[model samples]
Target: MTARAPQFCSMAWAGRPVAIEHQWIEAGPSNGPLLVFLHEGLGSVSMWRDFPSRLCERLGWQGLVYSRPGYGQSTPRPLDEPLPPDFLERQALEVLPALLQALGVDGTRRPLWLLGHSDGGSIALIHAAHHTDSVAGLVVLAPHIMVEDVSVASIAQAREAYQTTDLRERLARHHRDPDSAFWGWNDVWLSPAFRDWSIEAMLPALTCPVLAVQGQDDEYGTLQQVFGIAAAAPHTTVEVFASCGHSPHKDQTERLLDLVTTFTGASSPNHANI
Candidate 1:
């Protein structure tokens, strides 16, 4: 089966019901474990292009792909609204669980693996740590365990580029409110307090196998990101690809996909969770 049209999952958040946009890729074994694809900071479901479909089809596993609030066709962020400093934490600790429940994804009833990129990867790590019983394993790409100066600089550059270039217009095609996605991600990363943000403490709590992959030439972060994860989480594996940039799925699709497919299949609960 191929990917189905987008669907919505509604749940209460901040005292109001919120709808998250999601799609199902029904290409694989109906009984196979689920692979949830979490996109990067600036990414939406459409920004992922056909990568999710290709990966799920090849692995023969059902997949769920979604765009968080203020991104893609989901609810747009209000212009005057500001995202909280613990936005990523909230997304992992609260939003994700609510979304899973709204979609009837109970980890106790089925195996669940998360494939997250960039910010999504960090969120996955946090979620895996807090909900070990629900997560089977994780394949995180370019995850940030700690804030870096390079990250701030790159985001600052993006801010400048947005004003001088056509970045906003291009992103508009993907996000309902491009400003919402851009500012929500940029402002938080560049904030002074955000410099001290780190998820290293959460790593030790993750008991499942973690395959942390990052590009050798990633500008947004460094090897420290994945290496830190490996050092913190004993079951973590690190992979740094050369001649690649930040987005491994886009920079090195074939190799990344192969590594993830094999990793997920190998991480049986009997092996990783043990």
Candidate 2:
């Protein structure tokens, strides 16, 4: 399958004229549901690395993949501008809704299935929790519902790598401004106030079925992340991959795709899979 070119849309968000970068994977049946792929903290449409296309192909699903503002070809973050502790809240409640509105997606039209990773996953949960009627289901990979020491350490090490290693140059290949991507995520995650950030209260509000997947060896978060999801949300399933790291899509693509295909089923079946 050929990849679609990246497209741009302009909207005011986060106090600026943000350019949202997005791409379409394939066309399924006209009445088919839409699977929107949300990238990781430092991820972009390019950073998804063909996983979305491959997954969409497996399930005969169409997908919309986008790079959030300050990542990939989207609007770059202003220098010296620090994101608020409520950044994740803003993305879920403000930015995502605006993008969906611009694209004419809502509860009335075609169904929406969010496939989010890392930071993206958290955003998906928040959106689904608040706008329960807008989503059919969700498949979240390594989402952070609460802060952990392990996550903080891994991010700290990443900061070291970015400064002392070639990680900056490597990330530059996918992002227009690497600093915008890195700092946008890093600074917020490392702050003292951010450590107190938690979305557990919002969990009970999730109305749709959810599939939470994570790696056994994930450095950023522990299994509590997924377990906590199950505790708060009744309609949820958890899948843990052994010998895997933070990114299950990258470390266990074949297995992850299978899990996603089964979990999401034909239309992210609005039923329990546990």
Candidate 3:
């Protein structure tokens, strides 16, 4: 489960060119199923730590982990312009496909399984909804289908923390420009227009198998996030883990791994070999 060095891929995003930081975790077989790991808001490749490597090793699948445009060691967001309300949509629709194409990941030849956390999970859902044939399945952790009051309250607290506490200093360890990563996500989420943002309508369009996992004590969101997903995509399997928060991979790693192993095994039986 040793991790390799970070790699960079150049692409255009948000009307400007940028570089994305990424890594590949190869295991078991060269041609085994690929699982792409998407990080959360204010998250980067380094922030994921060893989760991708461990998951790929356990599942015997190849893994791809990356930092979105404004996060990690990749290109920083422009200081002058604030991100638009549809930023997440642009990431899923524009950034992801272009990056995959640049990396020679042809989903038609081999569809990819996405493992996304929080904001990343929302991106995965949007991508699958638009490109049904290119996605195999999805494992979404604390994904938001609709913005909740609790989400706003937490984000507001984060804003306060960023200004008053040492949160920015800590985030600087993961991101090249903490302001770019934090404000780009924070400003939009707390915006008046973004309050009405919802990807719930896109759920019914998803044809891939989905496993929505959430924590019972998540401060950022509620179980309604997964429940709304289940209501729309009746085929989805939903799990709410007790004694867990926004991050199941961090708080309940073992149980989360077991759940993913079982879900992926059933979804892609051939790829679960060790």
Q: How many clashing pairs does model 1 include?
A: 0
Worst window of 10 by summed lDDT in candidate 1: 265-274
Report lDDT per candidate. Answer: 0.88, 0.89, 0.90
TM-scores for the candidates: 0.96, 0.95, 0.96
Q: Which of the two, 2 or 3, has more TM-score?
A: 3
Put down candidate 3 lDDT per residue, 24-94, tens digits, no spaces: 88875556588899899989999998889988888888889999988999999887788899988988999
TM-score: model 3 vs. ground truth: 0.96
Give me the runs in candidate 3 sitting further than 4 Å from their true place: 269-274
Q: Is candidate 1 or candidate 2 better by lDDT?
A: 2
Measured with C-alpha atoms, the lDDT of residue 40 in candidate 2 is 92
Better of 1 and 2 by TM-score: 1
Q: Write the per-residue lDDT of candidate 2 for residues 74-132, one digit (tens) a residue.
A: 99988699888999999899999999889776654666789999999999999999987
Model 1: lDDT equals 0.88
Off by over 4 Å in 1: 269-274
Name the lDDT of candidate 3. Answer: 0.90
Residue 19, candidate 2: C-alpha displacement in angstroms: 0.9
Off by over 4 Å in 2: 266-274
